[model samples]
Target: MKAIVCTGYGPPEVLQMQDVEKPRPADNEVLVKVHATTVSMGDHRIRSFTVPSAVWLPARMALGLTRPRRNILGIELAGEVEAVGGQVQRFKKGDRVFAATLQGFGAYAQYRCISEDGPVAAKPRNLTYEEAAAVPIGARTALHYLRKANVQSGQDVLIYGASGSVGTYAVQMAKHFGANVTAVCSTANVELTQSLGADAVIDYTADDFTTRPDRYDVVFDTVGKASFGDCMKVLKSGGSYLNCTPVLPSIQVMRAKLSGAHKLILGEAPPETAEALDFIRELLEAGKIRVVVDRKYRFDEIVEAHRYVDQGRKKGNVVISIV
Candidate 1:
């Protein structure tokens, strides 16, 4: 199996392509022949060790003190099941599936084995492998925070950075959750966000989005460029402020929920974070959601994809086809 192995954590260049032994399914696992996967912001963050010092310390304990515990760096994948363990009941050898690989993180390889109980789901019939591969990570994150926000139909929800992988899904899912969506992004992504069912668009380059007179019932800051305090000013009295970034202040906001204003919300999506994957899969299968692929890269070009995503201007997801 050809896999992208991270020799050490520093730059995208550290991800070296090598032929590694293919994994076999365990008694309760399924072996998947990966057709497509994604090079997400999470992948970059892990590969480069770009997390906050507080978060990094814990992550280092989990990943490794010196190098990563897991060598291959990928999570989201869409592919066909090549074989299933004897105990597997929900899937068979030919079942098409899409899933997030949690800590098992080996989707950068040509094959991966995942437990049937993992975030695995039947791939939506309407989507291509590339499209399905892009869903799990970003969609799960969006779903996690929106549920935290408890979005209501008539209430206004503002999605800052409503153009990134998670932001695009956040916009659409919030609309699906019945909120009137307002997307804040650059002029280039205005149409893309609006097309995803955003009721209004704010060009951040031309306007201070916080100054808008219409306060929102929920404000989701997907980019983390805005502070919780800054976002709260644009929220209605009881509105919640949600951020995707894993910054220290966001962690404090999460802790503050124990004593202080639950109004400021911080979303910490857990690994294997499949709690929201089922909902996202249903929405996709029902045609209520769509995957937004800003670009597609081959396995060999993954480092380039990382570079593009690191530029901080991607309109949507960046896919990497594994097959």
Candidate 2:
């Protein structure tokens, strides 16, 4: 098997391709031959060690003392099951699947082994390998946060940074939940956001969303580009504010909690589960949601893919074809 190993963490250049032994399934695991995967923000953050200052020490300790604890650096993949252990009854040797590796982070390879009951599920019948690969991380993140905020049907919802990976999914998910979705992105992404079912699109480059008189029942900052105070001003009383990025605790969070008028939601992402993956698959199959792949790169061109994502210009997901 071939894998891209992170030779310590610094830049995209640190990712080196080399021949490695193919992983085999354990007694209760399934061995997948990876066909496609993604270069996610989480992967970039880990590769460059670009984390919040408040978590610098803990990040370093969890990732590695001086380098990455894990060499391969991908969090999700879509692949075909090549072999399955005797205990793996849900999947067979030829089943196609998509899954989030989560903290396991070893998808930048040709083969991976996951437990039978892990965060893996059959790929949606309507999606290709590349498209399915893009779903686990972005969809799961958006779904988890939106559910946590208790998004209700017919309520107003605003998504900041609505052009990025999680933001793109959040827009569609918010709509699926019956919220009147307002997407805030740069000028170039206005149409793209609208096409994803946003009731209104705000060009953040030309205008500030908080300045408008309109208020939202829920404000989700997918990129953490907006301050809690700014978002709070536009949130309806008793509404919720969700922050997806990692940042130090803010006075606004404390104030919100104390005032009890608006709730501040920020914390670690929910763990990926098989049920979540299956839910996403159902949505995909039903045409309620779809993946927006910004670009595709060959497995050997992972460095180039990373460079593109690092530019912060990709509209949606950046996929790496592994097979």
Candidate 3:
């Protein structure tokens, strides 16, 4: 099997194609022929060892002292089950599936063995492999934070960086839950965000978004580029501010939650579960939500894909065809 091997933590150039052994399923696991996968912002940061100065030591220890703990970089995948272990009951041979591999982080290969009980589910019947591969991490993150904030219908919601992978999903999912959404992105993505059902779109490049008069019930920062204080200033009393790109438990967030009128929420990715995927799958098949593919790369072009995502301007997901 062919895989993109991360030589060490540095640049996208460190990712190189190489022949590797194919994975085999163990008891309670299924072997999948990987069809597509994605290079998320998480992938880029891990590969480059980009961590805040405060968490650098801990991040290095968790990822690896000298190089990535895992040589393969992809976190989610869409694939077909080629084989299943004898004990596997939830999946069988030929089942089309999509999954998050955040636990082991080895979806860059042509084949991956996943535990059937993990965040694995049948792919949405209406989606292509590339589209399904884009869902798990980005969509799941957006959904988790929204639910955490207890976003209510008829409440005003603001999402910053509403053009990146998670931002795109956040906009649509918030609308699905009946929140009045305001998407903030660069001028180039105003049309894109509007098409995702954001009730209003703010062109951050054209003006300061915090200066808007309408206060929000919830403000989400998907790209971690928004100023924390600025986001708080735009929220209504008792409103919530959620930051997706969290590295450590923030002291400021803790203090604000205790002393301020608003809530500052920071969370890691929720546990990937088949239940969540199944729910999202139904919405996808129903055409209630759609995926935006900014670019598609072949398996051999993994390095180039990372480079593109590092540019930090993708409208939505960037996928790599692996089969």
Q: By lDDT, who's the top model here?
A: 2
Model 2: ten consecutive residues of lowest lDDT: 264-273
Candidate 1 residue-wise lDDT at 248: 70
lDDT of 3 by residue, 168-227 (tens): 999999999999999999989999999999999989888898787889999999988887
When 1 and 2 are scored with lDDT, the better candidate is: 2
RMSD after Cα superposition, model 2: 1.1
Candidate 2 clash total? Answer: 0
RMSD to truth, every model: 2.2, 1.1, 1.3
Stretches of candidate 1 off by over 4 Å are 250-260, 270-275
C-alpha lDDT of residue 61 in model 1: 91
lDDT (CA) per prediction? 0.85, 0.91, 0.90
The model with the greater lDDT, 2 or 3, is 2
Question: lDDT by residue for model 1 over 1-323, one digit each (tens)?
Answer: 89999888887888899989988899899999999999887788788888777777898998877778898989889999999998999899999989988566888999999988878888888899999999988888888888877887898999999999889999999988898999999999989998999999999999888677888888898978876666767777667878877657546466556545546655576446344666777888899989999999998999898888778798789999988
Question: Which residue pairs show backbone clashes in model 2?
Answer: none
How should the candidates be ordered by TM-score, best one leading? 2, 3, 1
Clashing pairs for predicted structure model 1, backbone only: 153-178
Q: What's the lDDT for residue 185 in model 2?
A: 96
